[model samples]
Each structure stands twice: as C-alpha cells, then as structure tokens.
Target chain A: MAREGNVVNLVENFKTSIVMPTAQSFPAKTVPVMESDAVATSKRPIIRIDGVTKTYRNGTNALEKIDLDINAGEFVSLVGPSGCGKSTLLRLIAGLGTASAGEIDWPTSTYDAKGHPMPDLGFVFQEPTLMPWRTVFDNVYLPLKLGGVKRKDAHDRVTEALEMTGLARFAAAYPRQLSGGMKMRVSIARALVKRPKILLMDEPFAALDEITRTKLNNDLLHLWEQQGWTVVFVTHSIYESVYLSSRIVVMTGRPGRLSDDIEIDAAYPRNEAFRTSSDYGEYCTRVSAALHSASAAGDGEH
Target chain B: MSVIATEPRRLRLLPLHFMRSETAGRWLHAVVPITFVLFLVVVWEIAVRELGVSKVILPAPSVIGEALAQNWPVLLRSLAITFSVMIEAFLLAVLSGIGMSVIFARFRILEMAVFPLAVILQVTPMIAIAPLLLIWVGLDHVDRALLILATVVAFFPILSNTTLGLRSVDHNLRDLFLLNRATSWQRLVELELPSSLPYILGGMKISGGLALIGSVVAEFVAGSGSATGLAWRIVEAANDLDTPRMFAALFLLSGLGVFNFAALTALQHLLLRTWHESAIRTER
Candidate 1:
C-alpha cells in the first residue's frame, strides 16, 4: 500500500551543500518515554512523481530532471553524503518549496497538466519544530485544529497519534521538557495527527545516540506498516538507510542528485534479525560503494 | 546525602551579567536609615531649642508630626482624589498602548506609517502638550483624562516593547503556523500574541510607572490649583511649611509607583508562571 513501484527523479547539477546546515540541523529521532509497538511498513505507491526538477535561487541547481513514484505503504529513505537534493525533493513533494519547472501532480481522483501534489501534506521537519508555548497534545492536535476539527474529536485523534509514537504519558508536557528523542516523537505525532497520505521527513533522527536511533528506526517501520502511509525519509547515515528502508535512494554531493535506488529484498516486519544478517552487511557494502561513486561524480560536475 | 556544591564566585565578572543584589539583606539593612530618621528628629529638636531657631524657619520634627496627625483626614481625602486621577490616566494609557501595538504587529504598512509618529509622541515633552490638551479637551472629566500625563513616559514603552515582543518569535515556529495553513488572524492570536506575552508584560511593567507619574504631572498643571491630587497637598503643606505632611503625600506618590510596578509584576507572573523563565524568579 505504501511503496510506489517505479522510480522517477534522476537529478543533476544541484548546487547543494556537502555540509549544508540542514544535514546536522534535522531533528534527531527520539523515542517517546513510553510504550513501543513494533509494526512493519505497507507495500504500494500511493504517491507518483514524474519528471520533477528543482533549481534553487543563487544559481544552485539543487535537483535536475528527477522522477520518482512512492507507494501508499512503504518506508523509502533518501540517502546521500550532503547537499544532495534528496531533502529538496522531499520538500518539493511536501509542497513547502515549489519546483522550478515540473509537474508535481497528485492523484486526488484528478490530475491536470497544471495540477500539483495534494496541497495538504504532513511534513515532519528535521528540527522537531514543535511550538514552544503549547503542550505535546496541543502541538500534535494543531493540524486538526487548522483543519477545523473540533477539540472533542481532535483530542482522541491527538491521543492516538501520541500513543502511536509512545508519547501519550507526556501529552501535557512542553517540548523543552522532553529529551532529544522525545521531542522528535511529538514531531512525528503532530505529523501523524493529519493522517496525511504522504509523510515527508528530513533526517528526523540524526542527533540521537546509536541505541536510540536504531530503536526509533524499528518503531517507525512498525508504525509505517500499521498506518500504510507513504514515507519519504532523508538520511545521511548508511546504517540507518539500510535498517528501515524498503527502497534506499542514494544521492551524491553538490548539485545533489540520486545515484542509486537499491531495493531491500527482505520480508515485512523486519526485526532485529535483519540488521545482523549477512545480506544486510552485503547491502550496506553495495550502498557504500554507490555513495562514493556518486560523490566522485559530483566532483566531476564541479 | 550528597549535595552539589555551589560554583565558586568569580572576583571580576562581565559587567552586564553582574548583579549587585542583596535583596533580602538590603531589606533587612533598611532598619539603619529608618532609625537614623528617629535619631535625626531628636537631634533636630535639641538643636532647635538650643540654638533658639524660630518655628517659621524650620519647624521642629515634633511640630511636623503633630500637624500631620491633626490633619490626617484632610490629607487622606486628598490622597484618595489623587489616586482616582492616577487610575484613570494609567487605564487609558494601557488600553490604548496595547490596542495600538496589536494594530502595528498585524499591519506592516500601518507600522511603517505610524511607528515614526509613535516615536515622536514618545520624545515630545508631556508638560508642553498637557496645557494644549487641557484647552482643547476642556477641564471636565473626559478632558482631564485626555490630558493625562501618559504619552511619553507610559504609552511609548507599552508600544515599543509590545512591538518588539511580537516580532521576536522564532522563525521555525512561525513557519510551523504557515505550514498548518493558519489564517493571519489565527496566527496573531495563537502564535504572535502568546510569543509576545513577556515583552508586552515587560512593557506594561515599565509603562505602569510612567502612567502614574503622568497622572501626577498632569494633576500638577491642570489640578485647579488648590483642589488637585498629592500635588495640591504638597502645595498646601508648603504654604504652612508643613514638611511631614508634604513627605506623607510624597510617600503616597512613591507608594503608588511601587504598587504599579508590583501589580504588573504579579500579573506577569500570574499569566506566564507556567511557561516563562523571567516571570518565576524570586527576585527580578
């Protein structure tokens, strides 16, 4: 339900950062200090993008002539060194930033040439961008509030979102009070509250210690399975890219472009066993080589 | 039980971060000056009789005290009247200042257009403007309120600080609201206003003192001469050379200033107690 079966975006000449602030600044993934439900990801592309390109201001060709499709229920991670237009592609799909000259048409039971993706998107920022003044519950409920959902109906959904992220106990807490991983949970909960068909995430867990990051990766796949929403996750870490993603879209540096799309041949509800498997190590090695080749290609572009 | 030791105090410090506060100790130490007043009063009594200085030159502390006690009701009545004027002036400054700040925060063109005007109002001398306002608005209740000593001292801080607070919100948080598709009005109410609370409260705190001072200044000029606020009492005490009575009135005025400062501080704490750091401190 989640995986889009075909790949599209093959960007070129993206004037991106090898160490753009966005890479480090993306919100660190945090497991809420609560219960954990290990669900797996769905399979199928609910979102489709054909021939999408983004050129940022200042003559930075962030993404060039890219095309990709995402299924309704799948965990797809965009992996790159840095300044690879992976995040840009995610942002374009989220409708946060506009694409320079391509169609981002969504299948809303309608698709015109001029049509863009669904204007209503659930975007989890890299910085756990929770409002400081509101409680975790209020922050999560914010999307519903904007949609004009009454508080009574919004409350239950907000609770469920929190519970899914294992943050129900801390619903009344503020963002500043939470640990790094917990804050990310609230960010995830807020995104989930919208029930968006497509969830765009930008390295949402790069700040955490290794142990916490792996836990969140596992928990995320579980939730992806249960909810069946298309997820576009951006990551710079090779280990994380391999652990959770059904499809790892490897990108290269400066004029960030996608270099490889390696599909994980493993089965659903992938557990601790997958990470230690020999196949996983092989997959990691292949993706590592792909990343270096793309980086070398990017150097050639310069 | 293990206890965390306090960090050793540094000898030299960054001037801005350094605090010379001994709030509790200072309050306790106030006893010295208070008792000094008593000792001085006694010494004055002895010196006056010994030197044979007449009552007209400088009345004895005893004489001033007697006069204040004897005329207590009259001084109390005048204090009440002064307080009444102060309240009216303070309320008007607060209401209009906050109203205008909200306007400027929402409308950029209006801010650009009117902000200079506000700065002008802040720098303009109140004493110079009070007479004109008195003439135009008349000496009636509305006029009295209109010519209130509020513009420079009170209203400006309220306006400037409030505008500063509204503009000080974090960029990412602002983007969050935009992503949520919040309407402009919703952004103002849900995001801008709440974010601006500390600055607004701080402005209100500063403005509170300004408003009180303004009322007294206005009362001094337009206060029907013999029938004004604490200003009139000061004048009446001066006519009779009653220093204690003058001090008593002066005390009430200073007390009003203290009261305004504390009231705003309390209101700030009440509203922001849960979320804000500045409001919950033991000493500000």
Candidate 2:
C-alpha cells in the first residue's frame, strides 16, 4: 500500500471519506482506508522539475531543458561525465540557485503540527563541510538549534543520528581529530538529525580510499533502508551508481540534457553476494553502454 | 608497617622523578635565559668596579638596587601614576578599535571612506604631536593629554587585524550558514566573532607594549614639575645627575612591559587552547 504513487486517486478517496458520514460510523471500515490513503500521499512525487534550463553569467549553458520527477522512498542517481550539469541540477533542486527558464515545484511541502514549514530535505556537499571548531555532536545539533529547538530536547535526536552513522563514540571529538571517513560520517549525521524525507548527496565519498568508500557505501544503503527516505545522489562513478541506485539517469556532456533513464530490477538489501552476481554485471554493462553513447552524442553536437 | 612507610617515601620522590624526565626540558628552557641575564649583569658589575668607572657615569647593578630600595615610596607613587595612565589608554583603544571594526564589517562604504584617515593617524609620529596635544588640553590636565596620545598610538593594529580576521571566514562554512538561512546577527555573533578572536588577541599583544611606550613618551613631553610618572622621575634624575635613580626607573618600566606581554599571552592560551593550532601543545 505504501508503494502506490498516484496522489490524485488518494485525494479523491480522502474527499469521499470526508463526505460519507457512515464511513466514520463504522470503525472497522475507516481504519484500513485511512491508513492506505496516508501511505499513498506519502509515496507521491514530492518535487517536479519541468523544462528547466540554467545558463551562467558568462554565457555557458550548463543545463538545457531538463525535466525530472523525484518521488518519496525511491533511490535515484544522476550519473554523467565531468562537465555535465548533474551538480547544477542538484543545486537547483536544493533551491540554492534558480533555473533560467522553467519552474521546479515542491508539490508536497511538509509542515509540522505548529504550522511551521519543516525543512524536509537535507543536502551533503562534496566535502564533509563540518566546522573545524565544533565537535561532532555540536555540528549535528546545528540545524535543530537553528530551528529554535532547545538543547535538552535535541539531545536524543542528535544521539540517535550519531549512532546511525556509527559515530557514537566520537561525538565529543573535534573534526580535526577525525579521519576523512569519520568526518564524512559526521556530515551524514548532521543531515540525518533533521529527519528529512529526502536526502541529496553530491559525491560525498569521492575523497575516500576505495576500501573505505565501499564500506561507507554499504553503511549508507543500510541507513536508507532502515529510514525509508528518498535519496537523490550525484556521482561520476559508474560502479558506485550501479551498486547503490534503483534507477540511474545518464546525462549528456557540456550543455547537459537527459540522455538515458534505466531501471535495475535487483532486490533490496543488496550485499556482497549480489555484487558478485551475474545480474549486477549485466546491469553495469548496460549502463556503461548508455554512458558511451551519451558521450558520443555530446561529441557530435560540438 | 614497612609497606606503608615505604609507600609514603616513594610518593614523596614521585614528583622529583617526574620533573627530572618530563618537565625538566621546560624548566631548562626558562632557566637558560635567566642564567644568561645574570651572567651579563655580573660582567657589568665587575667591569665597572675593576675599570674604576665613576659612580656618576655608570652605576653598578647593586647601587641601582640600593637606590630603588631607598626611594621606594616616591618611586612607587610615580610608577603607579604611569601604570594607571597606560591602563586607561589601553582600555579606550581596545573598546573604540573593536567598535569601529564592527562598523567597518557591516558597511563597506564607511570602511573605504575612513580607512585612509586611520592610516594617516597611525603613520604620524605621536612624539611630534604630544606638545600640540599638551597645549590644546593645557598643562593642568596633562593626564588627559597623555591619554589621547597613547590611544592614538595603540588603536591601529587592532582595527586592521580584526578587519582581516572578520573577512577570513572559511568559504565552505559561510555557504553552509547561508543554506541554513541564518540571520545576519546570528552570523556575526556565532561565526565572525569567534573566528576573529585569535587575530584580535594577536593585535592586543602588540598594542599592549605600544601603550606603555606611548605613555612614557607623552610623559616626557609633559615634563617634570607637576607630573609624577616614572618618565618624569627619569627626567628629574637625569638633570640632577642621579644616574642610579635613572637606572632604577628604567628597570621598573621594562618590567611593566614584560608583565603586560606575559599577561596577554596567558589570556590567549586560556581562551584558545581547545581548538587553535597555535595554543595546542602537541607531544611530537
């Protein structure tokens, strides 16, 4: 029931449930219907990008007429060459910059009970970006403190996020004392403390060694499964995208446009066994072919 | 009974062993400099006595010490006056310098418009204008004239250092703060001020010495009839050819400068030991 993505049908059902007085009269009939409706609403696409284009001040066309939909609970990866605008598109989605042509809509703006617009999304940049002066716990407490949550109330959530990132012991340690992988974990814990519905990561593990990268990749997948939040990741690594994403969007070179959109039919909780399987190899080959053709097309345009 | 007796004896020797190994190097580092100064003073005392130098020409260290003890009441009163003037001037310079730097951080136009004027004030010699200040404020209010002169000499370093510090915020951290939608007031208090603390303290170390020097120079210009600062005492002793008294006053002045520098260093260490690289003492 939580896998349903049609919000229109859910709204219609919600209207009928409100109109029919007998629906509430029977407690048995109302419970399942209401639960399904809530699941459907949660599963709907939270953001829609329609015909968006971005051109910088120096007349470089970074992205041209890009359109995409990001639904809740789906893990999406944007993969492309170096000059492609995957990072630019992520910044646009983050509202850090505006698109030149079209509109990007947040269809479902989640609000708290107090009617304050909760920051329902978190962003991780290429670097860990932790303040060197603060400890891991204080860095994780920043977003909540900015939102006016008292320190006493924010303590539990901060501890939970640190534990999820496997950094519970390092909460009091400064960022300078941490290794690259540990600093990145502190960044992840900072993002997760807000309990955001969507997590946007931009090459978060690009600076780590291959062994550490693989370990963090597995840890991130486990956290995503346990939390059941939507993830939109940006990376240039073909193997990483194939291993982590449920759906991959390959983009064109320089003036980046959508080139290919492929889906992997693999099962969830993918571990080392699946990584060595024939099916994973096949998916990787297919995506590599798509990337090759996309780059070739980009060469022809110039 | 034997175990308890040996335990107390062993514990008493623990500090001696620890100092011999771990803290011995630090103690040596301090002792070497003091030992060198004492050696130099002994050489001077011997040279003066053996060469049969006139007492009026160059007083030995013992004679200077004796002079300091004999005129303790008058010298102490004069030292108090000079020390008070230095403190007042330093406080005024710090408050106004930090207040102006904040203004400059908030408004680029004001900084551009008035920064050159600050540079001009700094480059112009305080000694050249001390007489002018005395005339304007009058001889009766010599302390106030000295205050203005010292403040002028001590204000520039803090303004420049703090301005650089405020602009030195990490680019990535600034972007993160903006992404979180922090208010300007929050940015200044939480980010800018703490980031600028080491720089401000560094500037204070320099200005601390300059304030004392300015007080002494201004007192020289104020002259000796009514002013009772150490500088005036040096001038009166020079005229009377009392070389020992002159050396005594100079000793106190140098001691005050060293004390000021040591105090500021301690403050910097106390505040920045947790995070600043300069203050942290790594084993390696």
Candidate 3:
C-alpha cells in the first residue's frame, strides 16, 4: 500500500533512456543495403569487448587480452583460482577500473574520448556495500534517485526490487541491523532496482557462510531466470561456478588469460536435488581439471 | 506521561537507540532509597533535638529550611550570576572547540601545531594563571574570560569524540557513498554528522559538569566583589563562619551542577530522541 498515485510511476520518468534520432543502419539484413549504401552503424554491443587487457604494472598481469563477448541477456561467470583474472574481468565490465592495453566494447557502454555515449553500468561489490546510514528501501531507491526519478514515484520501484530479493519485509531496516545474508540481499535489491541491462557481480557471496551462500546461489539463479539481464559474475570457487553458471569462463593466474570456456549443461531452475546430484559432481570435477590446466600452463612443455 | 517503560525483556524489541528503559523507571526504582533518605532525615531531626546538638556545626534540616527562606534572594542572585557565566562559557567553548576540531581533523599539520597548545591550556591550572589573567583582563572580564578557559578545557572531549565519530564511518558504507560520487558536503551531511551525534552528546555530558567547576574556580581564584557569583558567596559565608549559609551555597552549587547535567541529558534525549542508542534504550 502506498500513498496517492501509482507507485510504479517512476518507470515513466525513465522513458528518456534511449539514444537520439539516427538513420536506420543495419549491417546487411538482406545484403542489398550494405552493398549499395554505407550507413554508419550503431557499433553498440548490447555489450562490446575489444582487445581488453589488464596489467597491474607488477609485471604481474591480472588479465591479458580479456576480449570476451557478452550479448544482451547472457549469464556469464568468470570462474578461476584466487589470483586469476575473474574478478578483474568483472571490474572492467563494471567500469570500476580500466584495462591497460585493450578496450571493452559493451556496444552499450563504449564511449569515445568526448564521452558522447557509453552504456550505464550497475556494480554489485563482493560485499553488500549497503550504506549503513540508509534503510534497505532507501538503498534500493538510490539508482532511481540518481536517475532523477521523483521521490514519490521511486518508492514503488524500490519496493518491487526489495520484494524481488525477498527483502521487502526488512525494507526499513538498516544494513547493520541485518544478518549477513540479508545485507547481501539488500545489495542485490539495490542493483536490480535500477534495471541495468548489464549486472556485474564480483564474488558477491564469496565471504558468506555455506548454507546462506547456497540459498543465495539458488535465489540468484531464479532472479536471473526471471530478469533475463546479462550477468557477469566473478568467483574463485569452482564449485560455485558449476552450481550456478550457464557458461563459465575459466582463466589462468599471474599473466591472467582465458584458460577455458566450459558450458554448464545442468537444466534450468536448479534446486537442492541438483546441488546434491552426481552430475553436479562430475561437472565440478571437469571444471577443476580446466582450472588445473590453466594454473599449470607451462609445466608440461619440457 | 506514562511514557516510561518499567519493563526489561521488551528492551530488545525497540530499535537499538530506544533501549534504555531502566532510566524511565527511575522514580519507581528509587522509591525505597528515597524513603530511606526521608527516614534518616526524620530520625536525625528527632535525635538532634533530643541530644541538643548545637546549630553551630550541624543545623537541623528544619532550621536550614528557615535559613533557605531568609537568604533566598541573595542565593538566587548569586545563582543567576554563576549560571549565566556557566552558559556563556559553555557556549563559547563548544563553538571554538568544534570549529578548531574541524580544522584540526582536516589538516594534520594544524592538529600537530594546535593540539599541543590545547593540552597546554588544559593542563595549566586556572588559579596559577588567574592573577596574571586578572591583571591582563580586568578582574571582572578576566574572571568571566577565565570561565571561558574552563569552558575550553571542558570543550575538548566533545570535539575529540565528535572528530572520531566523523572518522569512524564503516568502509563498506564509505564505498557506497563514494560509488554514488557524492560531493564532500553531501558525504559529511549524510554520513558524518548522524554517526557522530552519540559521541558528541556523550562528550557534552562530561563538559557540563566541567563548565560548572570552571566557573566556580574562576570565582575562587579571582574572588567575588560587591556583586559576583555563588563562589564569591561561598567565600563570604565560609569566612564569616556562617556554616549553614556556606552549606546552603554549596548545596546551591551542587544543585546547579545537577541542573546543568539534567538539562544536557534532557536536550540529548530530545534531539537524539529516535536516533541514539542511549536514548533508544531510555525510550524503550
């Protein structure tokens, strides 16, 4: 129950969230247009990646040539060992940091030097990162608030986001007042409220206790299925990757590079039965071997 | 107002700030001890009359009541003098202390340069410098200004505590604000001030008592004249060996101290009514 007008009215305020007037520029839908005429394309990659390399200047490279493609609604997890480039990969996607040599092309986010255009990004840190001073509802309202939505209109979207994360009951609670699991849910709710096309998570629950992590894993899968947004999740744990991913991009350590791309064949709507199944174990074993191969890149050359 | 909770287990149910219910139950809780004090006073009155103890040393409570009535105006005037000075000093101390703390907090070099001076000002006894200060600033203003010195002495704890409160923001919370790209002013208003409130209130509690002491000592060091404060009255009463008047003035001084403390405590409750843990406990 909310006051006065429709609480979901904030969505109307965000109607200006698209590019300006542009001529139709298709690549070659029928091969007649491209051959006859050259109309400059949008070059937007729902998310685009172009030769993105990250070097830490320690001679210790975190990610090298991290050129990976992410489409509009793809769920991709960069899974590897602790020092591998998985987290780095997510950070670049989130626009939290920059790559040294390559460029990230999220046709949605790539911008020229003048910054005329770039995709908007929503980042979920490894921790909840909920502002301690803000209530769960206010925290969720942040993106809409920043997006210039009026306060009254923002409440509905915030409430909807909290409800999606099962945090609606605790909407008025402060982060410090929440359990660790609940705080993580609040963070997720905050990210979802913005409805960003690209959601980047960097080891979101790596620090959580086992049961809580498992529950969040399943919950996250359900949300992912419902939202159908592109998710780039980063985690060091192979088991987490096997359990939750639709596709896993494993990477090597030090001079971090793509080690392997393994597709998870588990059926959708995974539950407790799937988590405990032999197929899950077999997948976990296979992921581990891929990680080992990545870790031991040059050892067998002799 | 039926506002106080006489219960305990319900403590955790309210938000953390409103948890202090034991205080609201104070009157109900202190009933036995208050009755005991009354009992002692009555018994002592009977014994004093029966034993014929002289009014010279220990006056009867009943007798003192008469003296209070007789000297009420003088005592009230002196109280007005002392309280006014105390309020002025307290306000001045707070303004200067917080202003400096902000500067000191933001600039390490200023902290290094000014903190030692603050310590020197605090540790240097007020009386020893009183005569010189009295000379530098005429007796009246010097004494009042010395009241400020006491105020400044009293001001530091709050400033330091408030400074720490401003700094102790959680890292995760800090990152959230940073990610929002909040301006410095926005960060300070939204984060620093709310978090520092409890500490600032806590510091003010101690400072209230200190302010009263500073005023009294300033009067003590630079003795009161024809028209001065309670400290002057105390000196006059003690010298005349009018023990009851002296005790009466002492009682007034201590009473004023308690009064100041209560006002601060009440103000703290009013301001932080919904926000502070101590206030929350009290409310619950």
Candidate 4:
C-alpha cells in the first residue's frame, strides 16, 4: 500500500523535473528501472539523478553529466578505479556536498522548512567513524538522541541494532576496547538504529580482512533483505559488487562518467557457496571487462 | 615471598623485575623517593657537623626542624593567607581562561584582536610587572595585587590549550553532528567540551603549579609591606639573619607545590581514565 503512494509521488516528481528549465539537457532514454521489477510493478525510481555535474573549487571537474535512477529495494553498486568521483557522487546523494550543476531529486522523501530533503537516510563511510569516547550502546543511540528521543526511550532500539550487528555482548565496551571488526559492527549499528529508508555505504568493509569482510557482506545482505531498504553501495572490488549488487554501474575517472551498466541476474541469500560458484566467476569476469573498457574509454577521450 | 626469601641468590638475580606487580610498583614509587630524601638529609646533618660549617650559612636539618616547631603557629597562619590567595588566583584563572577560550572559539575575530596582547603579557616577565601592579592597585590593596599577578601568570596556558582543544574536534564527528542537525549549542556542549577535556586538564595541571609560583613571586615583591604570606616570612627571616626559619618557609612552599600538582594529576586520571589514550592503561 505504501509502495502505491510512492508511485504517485514518483509521477509528481517526474512532472516537476520535466517542467524544470534545465530538463532539456537530460537524455530521454536515461530513466533507470530494474529489469526484473520493471514488468512486475512499473514503479518509478525512488531517486533520480538528472544531468548532474560537479566541479571542485580549483577548476577540477570531478564528475560530469551523471544520469542514473535508483529504484526502491534495489542493491546498486557504484564500482570504479581510484579517484573516479564515485565517492563524490555518493556524497552528493547523501547531501554532504552541493552539485555544481543539475540536480538530484529524492522523490518519495519529505523536505524540511528549508526545502532540503530531510535525511530519512544513513551513510556509512569507509572508516568506521565511531566515537572513541562513547560505549557501543551509546554510540548506536546517538542518532535517536539527536532526533529528540530521550536515552531511556532509545534504549530498546539501541539494543536491537546492536543485536542485529551481533554486538549485543559488547554494548558496554568502548570503541578502543573493541577489535577492528567489532568497531565496524558498532558503526553499522549506529547507522541502522534509525531505521532509515536509504542506506548509502562507501566501501564500509574495505579495511577489514577478507574473512571478516565476507562475513560482514553476508550479514549486510541479511539485514538488507529483512529491512527492505534501498542500498547504494560504493566499492573498488568487482567481486564484492557482483556478489552483492542487483545491478552494477561502472564509472571512469578524469571527470568521471558512467560507462557501463550490467545486471548481476543472480538469486539473493548469497553465501560462501555462491561466492565459489562458476556463475559468480562469470559475473566477476564480465564486470572486470566492463571496468577495463571504461578506463580505456577514459584514455581514448583524452 | 617465602620462595624468593629461601633462594637469596635468585632474589639478587631477579631484583630488577621484582617490582612487576602493580601494587609493588606503586609502593616503590612512594617509598623510594622518601628514602632517598631522608638519606640526603642524614648526609647533610653529618657533613655540617663534621665540617664545622657556620650555622649562619647552612642550618642543619635538625635545626631547621626545631625552627619549624617553634614558629609553627605563625607559619600556619602565613600558610593560610598564602593558600587563600593561591586558591583565589587559580579559580579565577580557570573560570576566566575557559570562558575566554570558548568566546574566542566562537568569534575568531575577537581572538585575533586579543591573542597578540595575551602573548605580549605572557612573554613579559611577571616580576617586572608586579611592582607596577602594586602601585596601580595601590599598596593598601596588596592582596588584590597579589591575586592579579598570580592570575595573570596562570591564565595563559589554560586559555591557549582550551582554545586549541575547542577547535580540535574530529572532522568526521563534526560531519556526523551536522548530519544529525545538531544545534550550535548542542554541538558545543556535547561534542566540543567533552573532546577538549583532556587538553583542558593538561593545561590545568601546568596552571596549578604556576599559580603557586605566581603567589610566591607576588608576596616576595610585596616584601615587608605585606607580611602575611610564606614568601614574606622568608624575606623577613633573611633580613633578620634567621637562616633556619627561611629554610622552614621554603620547605612549606615546596610541599604546597607538590600537593597542588598531585591533586590535579589525580583529578585528570579520574576524569579521563576510561576514554582518553593518555589516561587509559594500554594493557587492557
């Protein structure tokens, strides 16, 4: 029923964007709808990226004419080489920075009095970014606390988030007392406690060991399935993107632009078995080739 | 203990590592320094007696002790006066310095306008300024002059350290606060103040010692005109050629300085033991 309301909001957003003065610059065919879900609902994308470009203060063009849309409940990965401005795009989506040109529209989200969309969203950075001074429970409770929930009221939700991250036992422990993996779990719990509609992660498990990263990947998939939230993940790993994403968007550097879009076409509840499957290897190879050609495209343009 | 005692040779061989236990290390820290000081005192007493050193030049430790006992009441009263002045100066410095740093952090322009003058005051020797302060405040307000001098001496470290601390918030944490839509006041209280605590405590430790030194310097400058503080007692005893009394007063002043430092250190440990890298035990 809520999904029906989202469809209505999407139409309204589409109308507004089309009426915008700069809408003529956007290509007509760039509206992204997931292949599997397109036939099922014809539901509009939750977030629309239309003709977006970002240039830094020193005249470096970080990203150029980015046009993509993220459908609700989709797991999308933005994979690119280093300095490719994928992180910049993720930050722009998170509203951490302003777009130099064009706009990102979050159609289904509510706006504050300032006309900026209020964050019903969570962002997990490459670093764990937990407060060293706060205990695990208190760190997780921070979002609720900032949102005007008293500590006593937030206690249960805070505990639930910790339990989800398998960190219930360490709720009383300080960040310094926890191992690297445990600290990252605390960071995840903090991001999840608010139960946001969108979860934007930028290489969240990149610093962990392969075994820990794999375990976290499984855990994240479990949470995403249960939570039913849209995840736009950013990573440098092709295998990670293939194993996790419903669709992969490949980007190239030197004024980053999207060069390839491929659907993984694999069933979820992915495990260690799926990781070792031949199907996984084929997808990894396909994504790797896409990345290779994208870099080549970047070179040819220069 | 019995096993080590039975093997005396083993005890000698393992002597260095014997204080590995935390309680044993703590005991050594307290007992060893006192024993060394006592040993020095005993050596001094014997040397002065053997060399027939003039009592006027270097009083024996026993004679200084005797002088301390005889003038205990007067010394205690003088100590009380000095204690009050030092406490008032330290408290004033703490409140004003922290308050000023917070203001400076909020208004960088004000910090720029005032910081150079602060540096000028800090670099200029307090001794040279004490007499002028005495004249400006007038000799009748000698206690006020003493407090102003001490506060000026102790104020700079707290102001500078706290200002640095207030600005040293983690950039990622700052972003988190922004994302949370934290009001400016909430950010200051919940984030900035707690983050600055260790630096503030460190500055307070240095400022605590300086407060005592400033009080003494002020008293010395005030001279016989204000004869209530220990420094004034020292000056008076020196004028009368009472070397033992002077040594006794010096002893009390040093004792007070040590007490002030130890108290501040304990407070720092209490506040930061669980969180700060400086205060936490690395082992666990």
Candidate 3 lDDT at B101 equals 65
Taking the tens digit of each residue's C-alpha lDDT, what string does model 1 give over A253-301? 7776656777776887888899898677766776677787889988888
Q: lDDT by residue for model 4 over A82-196, one digit each (tens)?
A: 7879999999998888999978887667799989988578888888887777788888998888888999999999999999999999999989898888888888888899989
- Each candidate structure's count of clashing pairs: 37, 0, 18, 0
**Every candidate's chain B TM-score:** 0.75, 0.90, 0.83, 0.93
lDDT of 2 by residue, B1-284 (tens): 12333434444623555555656767877888999999999999999999989879999999999999998999999899989888888888888888899899999999999999999999999999998999999889888998999888989988998889888887666766766777888788767888888999998889888899999999998885467899999998999999999999999999889889989898999988777888766676
Model 2, span A126-165: residue lDDT tens: 9998876678999999878776789999999999999999
Categorize the docking of model 1.
acceptable
DockQ of each: 0.41, 0.32, 0.15, 0.51
> What are the chain A TM-scores of the candidates, in order?
0.81, 0.83, 0.80, 0.86
Error of 1 at B16 (Å): 33
Query: Relative to the true structure, how large is the alpha-carbon lDDT of every model?
Result: 0.73, 0.83, 0.72, 0.85
For model 3 the TM-score comes to: 0.74
Best-first order by DockQ? 4, 1, 2, 3
DockQ of 2: 0.32
How close to the true structure is residue A281 of candidate 3, measured as C-alpha lDDT? 69
Q: What share of the true interface contacts does each candidate keep?
A: 0.35, 0.26, 0.12, 0.38
**TM-score, cand. 2 vs. native:** 0.83
lDDT over C-alpha atoms for residue B102 of model 2: 87
